[model samples]
Target chain A: MRLFLLAAAVFALPVTALAQEADAPLELPPVVMSTEHPGEVAVEPYDRSNAHAGATPFEGTAMLEAFHGVEGIGRVVDAMIDLSIEDPRIAGTFVSHDMVRLRRVLKEQFAYILGAPVDYSGRDMATSHRDIGLQAADMGALVENLQIAMDREGVDFRAQNRFLAKLAPMKDDVVTR
Target chain B: MRHCQSIGVVASLIVATLAGPASAQMFDWVPESRAGGKLLLTGGVSTIEGSGGGGLATWAVTSGYGAEDGIGGNVHATYVNLPDYELRSWGAAASFWDRVEVSVARQEFDTGATGALLGLGSGFTFTQDIVGVKVKVLGDAVYDQDSWLPQVAVGVQHKSNDQGAIIAAVGGRDDEGTEVYVAATKLFLAQSLLVSGAVRWTDANQTGLLGFGGDRNDDVEPQFEGSVGYLLNRNLVVGAEYRTKPDNLGFAGEDDWFDVYAAYALNRHLSVTAAWVDLGSIATFEDQRGLYLSLQVGF
Candidate 1:
């Protein structure tokens, strides 16, 4: 009888302690959302369908992936270079002797847009453009060309604007004649 | 028999401890009966008055602490961008026992003005220090689930412009004046909307630290502020807001304005927001529209 009572008390101790701790405020787990594809759905109660049903779809990760991959990046880079060459204004502003530097800038920008792991280590945009003499007209043209490139890749307008917001602050630095 | 008595005594003591002041104090912070401890961050741009006038479009970051029932506080920093000058302000606030809030802020306006206006060459700067207090007189915006009336609060911001020479040159009356205001704010949880309206009574000429001169009677004018947001998930909110201001200064006409904004809660510790503002013209200054963006990280 004595042994059974002792065993019962020992067993009850952990349960009671757990009950008290459970009553306290437990830390909430970090919420993670799916980034696999634009159409992928998350499981509920982790689902945000009702809350974010109206959100602009996620496109940055996929776009970044396309830039990182050899074939996709090659095609996009060729198109960008071809467009720049065809447009004298773009050619004047983007005049670079180092193809490697240009490629690296493009890669860094893609990574930023895709929320990937990358840091931009290029020359300061303002200092580089100090001698180029870009006007508002040139800025407008650059936006248009970027828009065309985004459209070719099926990027939505809102998502494109989100990306542009990150780049807009550079205007102050880049447009100083 | 002695062991049983000892167990009984221990149980009684535990029950007594559970019913003591410690437990009661814990309950006070639990946010029960109130939607407490919500950290709110907000900013917008508008004309200082209701007509066409050029005022600084502002971007601010603020964070609220504690519960609606108990003591709460907030700290904010603002940057105002103008055509010729830039103003920066930092402030801290405290709300005591959930009934009163007191705040203090310091401002610096630098124009880098050279060869302009009264031999006050480049590096001409204007500074102001403001002290504010607010009291919640009636109504609750969040917890009174059955009512439509929002949380109504009355507050005052007293400003002391440090530019004594400018005030003297402009023939201003007092370097210090109080702006007393009443505001009503509501949160529509279902629609993810926040609406607010306010009226301010003040003697200060402009919302800017530069005191308004001339024969202007201390008058009360109605100001309105409202926001409608769409929750793009729990972490992201896309919204718009419109706020009105009193045209205390007669130099330029003040016109109210509106903004479209989007905010993403990166986590509990960080948030990023962007806004497109259409600030109505100040007097002859048309197209006072611009973009405002801000990022906030908190613990």
Candidate 2:
């Protein structure tokens, strides 16, 4: 009897409504859970699809906000640097690295690329690593580490791609081998 | 005779390309082949009229294998069979500088038994030759998937029907006409979806088979076409298209066209498309519906 009731409820949903429900949260997380007033009963899991307009998380400003200001960008760069040093493919490049200086440059580069007002005054990509043998494998490692850091930071997938698109061109300057 | 010569040239080109050391088709498995910056499936299927589009509507994508800074070309053969009519077509298209496309197609429309009703012999057919050119004027459909701006193009198709005598006898005022169209197509990567819409200004009746205008209506009218496609996987795309057409002939009413289709890329060299199509009415025949199959091989 319980199974029958469950099946009945599932079948009762209009296909369009079910489609909207499935895709709505998959694109943008609207309401995981919400409660404002405790005095009266509150509607848990509110439907806010129409409540917001032109504020999709994919907008440039919204994407920039996901980094949680300069602090979060710093954390992302730190994670990437840490992961790069652990990966066997590019670990040797970081063996003699100055962690503090690299972190600051990465933060500035990311901040400028993500639409922050800050200017990146660090050395151009080639000038900074002129002697290092940056091979294709090293570039691959850098990309993988950056991806992992973005995932850890809870950055929206679209925002991660937007950031990576700007960095992809740097490969020409960095990867000589 | 001219049509036969054109067919021979296109057929020879297809064979020569297939047998050559170079593969003109975009083979995704060989990523190095696309050093010129083109990607797989960005070149859409050939429309029935021989432009880059879905089954029935023209899209904004450039045709053939050419990418950002090169030239690419391809040939296609399409067959459509309905309850009372059939259409066979062959064409070749080329994309240059990844911005402009030019194509030519020859269509043979078999009236079947309906020819007998029109006082023409059974199995009588009408033929037309079409020349088309499109110029990409805006955004990139593939790389700009993260944004809402779609790729846009504007084009024109000039069609000339061969059976001028029969066409005039059936109330058609002219044997030739041109279609001017503007189309936009976009790809949304996250949802694996592609949607396109186009508006066209045309005066042709039965896609110019029975010819343009008539004693009934002599002016060009605007029509619309749209498509929605979903990628089931990298190798296949399933979609549906609808195109509105004008009814300028007083002899019989015309209905809009629609199709649901699946297109599969076997490799860059070849792809096959099959669709269930509804063309509404042809001549005086009612409720025309059938299967559409097309085979395209390219480099």
Candidate 3:
């Protein structure tokens, strides 16, 4: 009987320890624990959670301010339009019709630049110029005029070039003469 | 024994040294011109090189936008400087799925008849309307994970001279023609460069808009265009391109031209570009040099 009790004690001790272990919180892989879902098995909170929750103050507001800084783009757009009209190089190229188009185009351009909701409904550029004889020299003048306008607006040279690069493919259609 | 140990150590050291850098360099051949779901604004001045007998040099500005999912559109305006005349043009384009693009444009080439050649005096305008379509047959220049060849595309431009009566009087045949072209473009990310090359075949006469007045056989000639650029950063690129135009004139040959250009990206929403060009000559005229600049803004 004493021997049985000794064996029973050993077995009971092991079972009790196992039950305690089963109730204990689990230690998961770092990635798995880091991505803990609400429905996942409960786990002991790691120290990292304290650091994660202690995010910088006003982070959302800071981001909003940074975005608002781009609002200056409106001034740049206005400057561009003014420069187009004031600069003789580009001004000479514009017809009365082009001026009307310019106003609408600049307005839409600024709205989009400022991340405002807008849709462009301007006439097709090619169709508009069908009657006007365009020469390569004219294209050169227009390009120079644009550069001057950009320069006045404080647009960096590299930023200006990025904008120009997107327009290169239209040479085939635009240079009809 | 010491020598063997030294060799083993050296081998391990070498392996360690190469492993990290090799893994880093594994992404070299991937194409960088991916569809970023934002508008792409590109423009430049290009001269017709020496391919089309002799032609005039010109400057042009163009703008384009890419929709969120590979759908996009573009527009362009250009001016050409001739010795005795000036020309102007504008165009627009739409791209679908980044695999196909269609465009329609108009051009007006004015020849001031100062010299007493034809009874018509100065202000003789040659106008043309063009419809174009391009389809990518193979390769994606912007999204190849690993490849050396650039993105290849085939396209066609159909031109119709709006001044049919004027063209007919000048001995033109219907004032319409078709031009077919194939182009390839690639961006070298490590070098911050983009390169494009193209060959075009056309049935248009030298009097591009005027058509052929004589019984000249339609010439199917190959034209070439190429661009080389240095990327300043992710948003800005400055480049140069050389384009060869087809000589459509049966008489009074034309000379080709080339352009040097610079471009800038303002943000995800806007960009601009400028270029200086040398348009060789049209027929006997010379000294056709000019500049081009444009601005583009999109969502």
Better of 1 and 3 by TM-score: 3
Q: Which stretches of candidate 2 lie over 4 Å from their true place?
A: A1-177, B1-36
Off by over 4 Å in 1: A1-177, B1-36, B39-63, B68-74, B96-98, B114-120, B216-230, B248-251, B278-287, B293-299
True contacts kept of 2: 0.00
Question: Candidates' interface RMSDs, in order?
Answer: 19.3, 7.8, 13.7
DockQ for every prediction shown:
0.01, 0.03, 0.02
lDDT of 1 at B127: 71
- Residue B220, model 3, lDDT: 68
- The candidate maximizing lDDT is 2
Cα miss at B292, model 3 (Å)? 3.0
lDDT of 1 by residue, B55-148 (tens): 1222111122233333333333345455545545544454454456666666665645521543557767667777776676776443332357
RMSD in angstroms, all models?
23.2, 19.2, 26.0
On the 0 to 100 scale, the lDDT of residue A171 in model 3 is 38
Predicted candidate 3 versus true structure: per-residue lDDT over B225-251, tens digit per residue: 666777665456676767675554454
TM-score of each: 0.47, 0.63, 0.49
Q: How does chain B score by TM in each prediction?
A: 0.67, 0.91, 0.69
Total colliding residue pairs, candidate 1 = 11
Q: List model 2 lDDT by residue over A1-112, tens digit each.
A: 0011222334445654657745553232222221442222222332232111111223356656877767778889999998988876568776534454467657777776
Per residue, candidate 2 scores C-alpha lDDT tens digits across B23-89 of 4243335442221234445688888888888878899998865665445566788889999888888
lDDT, candidate 1, at A102: 54
lDDT ranking from best candidate downward? 2, 1, 3
lDDT of 1 by residue, A97-116 (tens): 23444555555444544565
